[model samples]
Target: MNRVDRLHSPFEQHSRALAWLAVFGLLLAATNLRGGLVVFAPLVLEIREALSLSASAFGMLTTLPLICFAVISILVPLMTRFFSSITLVVFGLLIISLGVVLRLVASYPVVILGTLLLGSAIALLNVLIPVLVKVFFPSRMGLMTGLYSIMLSLGAGMGLYLAVPMLEYFGHWHYPVMVWALLPLLTCLIWLPLLKLRGEVKPVTGARVTLWKSATAWAVTLYMGLQSFYFYAIVTWLPNILIESGLNPLEAGSTTAMISLASIPFNLFIPIFATKMHNQRSLVVLISLLSFSGLTGLWWAPQLAPMLWAALIGMGAGGALSLSLSFFILRTGDGVQATALSAMAQSLGYLLAATGPVTLALMHDISGHWLTALMLLMLLQIFQFAFGWKAAAAVQIKPDINTHSSKRTP
Candidate 1:
């Protein structure tokens, strides 16, 4: 088919119904990405106590899923090439559901293995959903992206907040972990109808959309990586940091829950505002400044009004993340470029991003303090600011041949 034919075909018949269905599916998939990761964060103390794990062992448990995320991200593009995005999504949900169920069995090895499986599933789904947004909801990319990001943050916040209560009600960690399985299972059922509808959709092909050579692409990827690094590191370690700062377990958990909850509004609002701007660099600077301020407040002035600082950090981080996803759709010329850039940015970006939590965990294990870890996170924000400035310049990624010819290089 010709270019116009390809563009018009996907929406020719069932556009409205299909768009709604795709949005629903995207929200469900996005919701699942952090269920496994955050649900366990609030339960870290219980796991450590029950398993009698050392500091290093506890750190390993937190870091393993991120490692899996990085590894699985590398494989997603190849997997999508052979399988339909719908098929990959369904398979990812299945794996995540199975992993959640397996966690109930609760051998140490089994728990770690389940975490890996969950991360792998999340990695695949994370990469595919943006491609779907680009393909189906081209007109409402910012709105849909914001909606999905809010759902993701809400799911994560709820997962962390509810875990202790769920365990308290059920009298065991197994049920708390197992309860999340129902989400993906329900998502899988809702998505089953799409299986029959798959082969009817045409496949993407040709020039590969070459995002690797683009400066805008690299800048966005680095920004994504840096922001993710800080977010995950803080999520994984903040409760412990609070505990070290003299709060009891319940108080620390509550603080972390509040931070996660605060992210929802910011995630929803940031992209909407960023999309309206002629260029996004000022917003990027604003977000980075907010995040740095929050982190500094948390480290230096723990005795001050901590929740306010925490909320500021949450808002900034959430905004940064939502904007990163928004840029994935906004910076591209077409669905093909969106797909390639999404795969490239998320795969390599997540690989780099995964290092933050692991590094924080290692520092906590070795130095027996959270100060060094917090400093490292502050340093990451510097990189985030630099790259985000370039990414928000409103420039598009064109071919190197055209770029060079236009520049008249010496």
Candidate 2:
């Protein structure tokens, strides 16, 4: 058989069983994606005290992964030329496990090294998972995107909720962090079976598409960046905003939970719904309005209906994230193009995202209140709507690539 026929033969014969395996492995991998980074978040104070880190040092430790994401993502497309997406994912997970173990050594230099390794490993997974989705489940892009997107949020939530408990159970901050290594390790095992299927799926070799020069690619990148920025800033500051608005620590904590919880269902559904439509512009506008209205409520009268406002922001942020990810697949012609766009969007997008929390903090410091910061965020939603609208157009990165195998919902 020819190479194309060889690629199609196994899939055409055993599509159902292979698809189930692919979906399971993809979801399991998704669970490990964000959990490692967020697991560090809830353990921050404990880690800082244990490691004797200064506030700035601790901030850098937390920020390092985001910087890695921005830097490492740009290199993923290059790596694809040498390895299949599955191989990179498997290697990345093991590296993450090693990084987790290294951090438990309790030495400052060791911890920095470990954090760097963790960030670099995750950066690989971040850029390539969508490429896998496009390769294996092109026909169900929205459904698979939505499912993995929900898993990402689920993983983060589980990490946040479980981190302190793990610390208490192990009686050391190191052990709590170390225990998270189990996730990637386990996920690594789940993906092992897929390696044998690699013969059916090789990296796409084509004339390089210059994502940087495409206005549509830029639109997708900006949409991805602004939505990510809003998410990180709100997550970092919402509690403080609540406390400043006269709520007790307990109340603020509960409100934050409400925000996290509210996003789950929307994350579960929005991408699936978006893909079935003719275009996602309406969804983008809807998400921006929800975030804008929520931010307005928080700025003007947060005490009035905190839960309502929080939920709206959560839904908006969650939906925007899933939609932006969908753009990586929706806007591309094939898995190769998707990988390039995903790398470009995440590299620049996360570099922009890396600035989010710090910028908000700086604004609050300069203005002596969060009103200015909140207003700035509200203004950003306007730009998010504009870029997201352009990105939401029904088109492809390579118009000449045949799309018969991956038709959109009519």
Candidate 3:
């Protein structure tokens, strides 16, 4: 029998079991991506107290992981080329687990290093996920993407809300960090079966396509990067911003947690709706309006029922994120393009996005306020709206079947 037939042969006897295993494995991997970031955010003060770090140092603590995430994302395609996606994903989880363990055992400098390792692992997993969806759930891209995104959001929220309580119960920050190690470790266990499934089948070979020449490709990358820029900026600094605006630290963290909770619904619903629509333009416009309105509310009247504004922003951001993941699948004609596009968009976009939090911090440091920073963010949203309009239109990246020559224009 041929290779494709051999791959399917095992499935004939255990297709149902393998299908459920793939779904569960994907969910577990998705849930671990943002846990490190969200867990660190709520515990920043405690970490600061323990390490005696300054504001700039605190900023570095947050920024280093993002920088690592961006830098490592650029290398994921290379990693995938040398190893199967399943192998890379399993390796990533192992790295993340080690990072968490290191965080518990190490000193301040070592903790920062551990964060870098964790970020790098998460970056690889992030790029691989959509490719896996394309491979295994070709017919259910939108639905599966939506489900994974929701799991990611919910996991992030859990990390934020549970960290402090866990620390309190355990009476040490180390326990909190150490406890999360179990997640990736568990994921590694669940994925062990799939690892054995990748026996030395001659590597499926293909010619590589250059994605930089495609306008649609660049547009999608910029949109993904800019949206991530704003999203991470908010995730890293929003609590501090809200606290500076008069809310206490607990209240600020709670508010940010609520925003994350609000995303759960939007992440689950948006992709399903986007798949039914011809183009995603209307959804883009609507979400942008909601996000802008929310930002305006936060800037102008944060004292007046800020939770409503937070929820609005969360809903819009969640929808945008889901749509971006959907575009990674929809804009590509097949798995190869999906892998390339996912790598390009996430690597370049994340590198660009790494500036957002630092820029916001610098603006605040110089101006002694967040108004100008918010205005800058609003301008980014405007650009996002413009690009989203172009990217949401139906178009596919057609690669030359013989040579893998590809271009995206329409």
Number of residue pairs clashing in candidate 1, backbone atoms closer than 3 angstroms, sequence gap of 3 or more or interchain: 0
> lDDT by residue for model 2 over 1-410, one digit each (tens)?
01122232235555455567777888988887777777777888888888888888878877999999999999887787667778889999999888888877778899899889988998898888877877776667777888888898888888888889988988877766766688788887778877876666665443344677678999999999999899999988999999999999889878887877888877777888887888999899889889999999999998999999899999999999999999998888767778888999999889998999999999999999999999999999999999999999998765333322332210
Spell out the clash pairs found in candidate 3. Answer: none
**Model 2's TM-score against the true structure:** 0.93
Error of 3 at 170 (Å): 1.4
Tens-digit per-residue lDDT, 275-323, candidate 3: 7788889988988997898889988987686788789888878888888
Model 1 error, position 178 (Å): 1.6
- Ten contiguous residues with the weakest lDDT in model 3: 1-10
| Per-residue lDDT value at 115 in model 3 | 79
lDDT of 1 by residue, 1-410 (tens): 01122243354455455545666877888888887777876688887777777777766666677667667765665565456677788899999998887666647778777777887888888877876766665556667788889888877766877898998998888767776788998888778876654664434422334566888999988888888888877976888888888878878767776676778877877777877788898889889988999899888976475687778788888889998988887787655456566777777777776777768989989999988888888888898999999999887666444322222100
Cα deviation of 296 in candidate 2 (Å)? 0.4
Indicate the TM-score of model 1. 0.86
The TM-scores, one per candidate, come to: 0.86, 0.93, 0.90
